[model samples]
Target: MECTCDYILKTQPDWEEHYENCKVKWIAREKRDYPKNNDGTLRLRNKHLLKLDYDVLYHLGLDTKTHDLQAMFGDVKFVCMGGTKYRMKETAKHMANILDIQCDFKNIVKQGHRYALYKVGPVLCLSHGMGVPSMTIALEEILKLLHYAKAKDPIILRLGTSGGIGVTPGAVVISSSALNDTLEMCYKLAILGEEKKFPCNFDKRLNQELLSVADSEDFETHLGVTLCANDFYRGEARTDGAFCDYTEADKQTYLQKLLQLGVKNMEMEATAFAHFTSAAGVRAADVCVTLLDRLLGDQVTPEKEVLTEWQKRPAKIVGNYILKYYNK
Candidate 1:
């Protein structure tokens, strides 16, 4: 069967070779007959050797019987946020309940790979948790859904938690630009390296709205560079010398360098979202609540209570901004 993965693998020499080498290992896993579902049904299975076309899978959502992706969100506006399941689920539920809209969680591809789509008014709130890979997948899926639904004048918002880079803990950082450190690595790894530079641009109007809301709420919001790191724990250092595994001096030096680059916060997904949305000419912005002051050697864990409180301030600011902007 023709699949998007196949096309990508065949066209990219390095990827083709990598896939060829990995094919045997994939074959050892249990094979499930795909196309097993009727022409329109969406099936979920974990088979390694299935030839699934991403484009085909994406389009399947348009076929209502096959996948109810559209039905998932009615006429409500959509917003996207990021966090662990606990944090996201609770926050999404709160938003949905408050907004009086239906919100549902869908698994994007793997464990810890999930997104909550909440619709209220003319906005749709979509959020996910995981690192860069999951964020990329969610963005792709969201784009496909928006395209299939013929959604126009749609504005995408990213609400999530991040570590304070040069800023103080508890200070909210609204990303004006996401500096993609991983894109350079990915391009360099390519056999035929492309000279394309990912443009760092965001929706100007949306940014203004965020700033206005922040100002009105008297919240400290910084508009600067945000680094999207692939390895969160490894990339971020901890003051506690625990899971992050970085020495205090090392962490300070790294933070200083990042701050020199104008990075105010560090997170896992915004870079890719910014890159993709900018390329697609979509309106997108990310508002991240600072959970830890990495520059000051504060450790951030996925503690429920801490995250709950951390999310409330940013969510309130972003949520109010969205309501005011869209409502006006």
Candidate 2:
């Protein structure tokens, strides 16, 4: 019998054989103690959800009573999220090409009136908007849809663009862990006027898998903690915002503080995305391509065309991973 060490999956040229050969699972942790149905699907903690006859996923424009969720999303393996409708739509087209689904793909959630949703074979792509709050709502709705659909072992990936810390522009960042504004490795949100927190941690094996596949691309990929702020300006210590109270020195100090703490990039939605997905028992990764190095400046000085090109870095790396993993 081959050793079931996680390294075998990363080191072997024929990783799928080793992945199957290994008795241990690397991701989608076996939460045997958690509530599960006879069919072995993990149940949500919200008992009210299970009791309800139907769930209306308002943001995703999906409802159990309206659409056959099991038929729409049950076969979904990957949930890929980006920042815009256009980006995710393009991603759907990209994945469709990769999956050899030759057709003029349509936005499945255009009727939703909020976010854009598209499906390419086993991949589900969506635009998560800008910040944690925006991203959280979309996440909750989609997660609920997945739960109602009884999707099996879905892997979520947030493909986004961020401001790199000490790293160079166009480098893709794979967050080993996510952090909030106060530097905690957790996500904080208000529930019932009080507060609650969920871990922003990620599976190291998934990070390794992304990093390994990144070698197949010409772009650089870095692994480190990610700072998930509520805003792109003040929260990220940028002077470019409308209201700037702090000096450039203060901003430098703060960003340097992040660098010392191993934060490779800063984004708006990582903590919420990491926490919510983890809470739902879905394995997720925050992989963002840096638009600019904050250590150099606060502004993204690249041209629109260049920025667009940089934004595709994560998709390419992730697309490569999907191809390699799915083939085997």
Candidate 3:
């Protein structure tokens, strides 16, 4: 049963006292509705969060009371995200072909213009634009959506492109951990007038699974630390930006320092993506194809056909893994 306090609180003068009196009943109802894992434990951090009177995923065009989330997404087993809407749309089509799911993929989010989302059987595909802030907002809403839907232990994966540090172009780089520009494996954010640091960690078990799949397919894959920057130009130490105050020699030195620290690639969204997923107790992994070798040059120079084929590499491996998991 849904709690009634939320509706009453909007017009009631003394909602706090009402909540205090109804807290036990609400918590009990929550406990009874939520599903459990194999070991009889909830996978999400706050198991009863969505069971409260009012819960909303505003950015996702969804809310607990407005939609029946459990019926809509309770079967979702995998969630994939990238930087562009078109790419993820293609991915959804590809996933449908692999899984043999015949449903026509459609955009379920109509009210919000922030992101695009699609569903095919047990898989959910979404696009999280280009930076840390954009990725973070999408993730927060998705997590809440899953919570409200009572989705089971689902695996989340980020499939995208990055600039290689020492590896060759077109090679896949699976992030062992995401590091900031300072070479720290933590994300910094100012919360409540104070700075807080959260570890940028990935799922080691998932990485191994992806590596195994790549090896079986004979694909070139590298596992190393990834550097998450805030911008494409200055944040990445590139000299090609419109405004540059650094020299070529300075850029070379910085890239060399990152290579020493074991960073294999650079991108803009991994830090927040890894940090938030880990905090939410969701298993996550980042698999990106290298588009350019930063040590060789600052500009990306590859043929359209070559780039298109390279872009499909990460999806191939990730899609295979998801298929195998479901078949098992």
**Cα lDDT tens digits for candidate 1, 93-149:** 556555566745343333322445444445554555577766676676666566445
- For each predicted model, how many residue pairs clash, with residues at least 3 apart or on different chains? 16, 0, 0
* Candidate 3 lDDT score at position 11: 25
Full ranking by TM-score: 2, 3, 1
For residues 47-108, could you state the per-residue lDDT of candidate 3 as single tens digits? 47746797778888888888999899988878999988888888898899998998677888
- Model 2: CA > 4 A from native: 1-32, 35-40
The TM-score leader among the candidates is 2
* Residue 89 alpha-carbon offset, candidate 3, angstroms: 0.6
Candidates 1 and 3 compared: the better one by lDDT is 3
- For model 2, residues 184-212, the per-residue Cα lDDT tens digits are 99999888999998777876667778888
Shift in Å, residue 266, candidate 2: 0.3
Weakest ten-residue segment in model 1 by summed lDDT = 1-10
Using Cα atoms with residue i matched to residue i, what is each candidate's TM-score against the true structure? 0.68, 0.90, 0.85
Residue 255 of candidate 3: its Cα lDDT?
A: 95
Q: Candidate 1, overall lDDT?
A: 0.57
Question: For each candidate, what is the lDDT?
Answer: 0.57, 0.80, 0.80
